[model samples]
Target: MRQLAQSGKFRRDSTLLEAAIEETNTEIQERLKKDRIDFDFDPYFAIVRRTLKALAKEMIELGVELGKSRKSNRIGERQKFVSEAQTPFEVIELGLRNAIEGLVALPLAKECVLDLERIKQDYSVEGEWCPFRVSTGNLKFIVDDDGTISISLRNPSETVVKEAKEVLIALASQVYVGN
Candidate 1:
């Protein structure tokens, strides 16, 4: 009878134990919510975002510099032919031929090869001009009489082509004209 009374006194009530467990769970959940809120508003994330923006800007600036250098080299090559030409026809013919050949020999980023035989210069009587058309894989480059170059890519539909062309133009403009 004495042992039974002592055990009863020492025994924990189930209700009290349950209440304590529930209170601890609630506190833990609240702490987790607060931690989530702190993480969402962290200044480190803002710093990272700003750093990425700055890096992108710097990359664009570098691309522009590279494009300008390439343009200058092309201009120099054309100038060399122009200086040696006795007539305007020779200037146009020789310059276009040289430029197209140079482009054909240029190594692309990938292991892609451009067929030199496919490069052609067409003279238009209406415009009194000659433009070179160069084809490589699905891409075509048309060099106009006024030296303006345009790119065309093959697609199944006109709408798709237009949409894809915009993206290609954006990327090409970055590497080519840097605009």
Candidate 2:
């Protein structure tokens, strides 16, 4: 964390570094260092793991197959090593502050959300790469984006639904206390 912060990407804007200003690099360094030491993975990540397991179990019960999309893009590992942030600290500082609406980058993310729909697929997972494609659409969409956007209220073909139900049953059966 110290090495990443000292790399200088977290420096406040130069325009703000004016004469007579109370700001100092020493303060920034200390704060970053402090946050790094205080930053607990549990406050941001452990709960998330629990939540995913529960949700995945639920989805399986609901018979959501989350059929394969394209392929694994290794999003988790890549994001853990963002281009500007070779280290995790840089990514956190640059993206997430104290609370994220969120990584609370990328809600302690590369977070895979189940949109419960098939559309607008964005990121690709790394650690637990999914054979199924998904978007953090998280059921949230930009209401005011450019383009001819249209929403169709519908469901998949009967056969697809049947297959999904079958798969859901299979998965739900496999689900265990640790799952």
| TM-score for all models, in order of appearance | 0.18, 0.18
TM-score of 2: 0.18
lDDT of 2 at 153: 14
Estimate, for each residue in 17-43, the C-alpha lDDT of model 1 and write its tens digit: 333344545655677898774323335
TM-score for candidate 1, residues paired by index = 0.18
Model 2, span 1-179: residue lDDT tens: 22222233333322122211223334544677977753333343445444554443443333222111112321111123222322121112111121112110221222123332223223322223223322222211111111111111134444433343333222212211110
After superposing all C-alphas onto the true structure, candidate 1 shows an RMSD in angstroms of 29.4
Q: Whose lDDT is greatest here? A: 1
- List clashing residue pairs in candidate 2: 75-125, 76-126, 100-104, 103-107, 103-108, 106-109, 106-110
Runs in model 2 with CA error above 4 Å? 1-38, 60-148, 153-179
Model 1 residue 22 lDDT score: 47
